[model samples]
Target: MLKLKLYSIICRKYKFVQRESIRSNWMKQRKRTTSATSIANINVH
Candidate 1:
């Protein structure tokens, strides 16, 4: 149950980060790079 909760939290956080990344990507491309790195980190871990 605890693991499920953590997973849900991570999913929520990922979505939030994704939306922010998209918004910032319009102004600067750097954010997309960071977002890509974060995705890799998440997938790796």
Candidate 2:
């Protein structure tokens, strides 16, 4: 009933937030890796 519907909405919202957080973390990690690689290249030259 109503309670079940409310719980489903809350669950969906929580999942959405979790997905965005994971995506943001992945982007941050990628940026750090790319920066590290560039720095390594610079050191090589």
**Highest lDDT among the candidates is held by which one?**
2
lDDT tens string, model 2, 1-45? Answer: 999999999999999999999999999998989899999999999
TM-scores of the models, in the given order?
A: 0.56, 0.74
Pairs with backbone N, CA or C atoms under 3 Å apart (clashes), candidate 2: none
Whole-model lDDT values for every prediction: 0.89, 0.97
Candidate 1 on 1-45: residue-level lDDT in tens?
A: 999999999999999999998877775876767799899999999
